[model samples]
Target: MTKTVETPREREAALLIKAAASLQNIRDTWPQDFDQLSKALTFNRKLWTIFMSSAAMEDSPLPHQTRQNIVNLGLFILNQTRELTMEPQPQKLDGIININRQIAAGLRAMPA
Candidate 1:
């Protein structure tokens, strides 16, 4: 059997998908696992923070509009994450998963 290697973009997208899955899992098993939900949300927030920082870099190859859009989305995630942290609602995690999945899909669709 052969293993496939992923490009940087593909790796990032994979991670996003994994994170989304984790969020979904937490949602599916909500209330019974507050600790896991908090951990998942924290991890997701960290991922978005790194993405936002990378997009803000001057040497980033992404177009200005694309970078700006990512930054805006990151800001939304940051705010929503904070709210979720305070309220700890399972449903609130859906928005983060959807955003991550959407970005991951777009990344996967891009040519290497």
Candidate 2:
């Protein structure tokens, strides 16, 4: 049997999906797993930071509107991450998961 290597967008989509799953797991555990939740959120924040930086690059191949949208989403994620860190609620992870999953789905649907 042979394994197929994923392309850049596929890899990114997979990461986003994994991040969403992590948040969902944290949500399922509720307030019982602060340590895991914190780590998951930190990972998500780092991922978003990379995405935001990529979107901000002048040489990025993405369309202007797409870049702007990514920036807006990154801002939302940053603010939500801060809120989640401060309040530490299971429900707080929901929006982040949704956004991540949605973006991941979109990326997956794009033509290669």
Candidate 3:
């Protein structure tokens, strides 16, 4: 006989998987600047908390607007997650310095 999964448990598992994937993507993308990525992750967590809390509060005259704000915040968090996962790792200071020198040389060579 085949085993069946419960819908709630399945959804929970999927969410966990998605979170893990996001973490790994961020790690891979920002290997050198984990601090910035960590800050973004923390901000996303706070946004999620606020969204849920607002959703649970009693209805009011501004309930619809509040719900829309929550949705917009959720989307913002997701976009941040995606961005943190896509940014390339920064170069070392020495490498950055050398690149700046090269760009300066090229700019100086350009005609006015």
Candidate 4:
């Protein structure tokens, strides 16, 4: 049988699944060093937020509105991701983690 091509929504869902898997891997392979653990956590949280946002965009009813919202949200997520990747500061990590957790929880509660 020939392989089927994925639509944009399917591709987005695949990406989200990959990101979630990576997050779990990081959690499982937690580093003993405090700095390393912090970095891993920060990176995982950022990926999770992106994944959730992308999934949300996929599930949105109004395609144009969702695209616009994703563009705005994408900018914010990119800025935050940049900050997280830069210095690995506690405050930044905390903020990102909180937002990621909230988004993930909200997304989980949404009907699939």
| Candidate 4 local Cα displacement, residue 41, angstroms | 6.5
lDDT (tens digit, per residue) of candidate 2 on 53-110 = 9999999999999999999999999899999989988888889999999999999999
Candidate 1 or 4, higher TM-score?
A: 1
Candidate order (lDDT): 2, 1, 4, 3
Clashing pairs in 4: none
For each candidate, give its TM-score against the true structure: 0.93, 0.95, 0.34, 0.45
TM-score of 3: 0.34
User: Candidate 2 regions off by >4 Å?
Assistant: 1-3
lDDT of 1 by residue, 23-77 (tens): 8988898877777877787888889899999999999999999999999999999
Whole-model lDDT, candidate 2? 0.92
Candidate number of the best TM-score: 2
| Alpha-carbon RMSD of each model | 1.3, 1.1, 20.0, 6.8
lDDT of 4 by residue, 19-109 (tens): 4444344444543333454445555555656644664675656476645765565566557667756654444544444444554555555
Please report, in order, the local distance difference test score of every candidate based on alpha carbons: 0.90, 0.92, 0.48, 0.52
- Number of colliding residue pairs in model 4: 0
Worst 10 residues of 2 by lDDT: 29-38
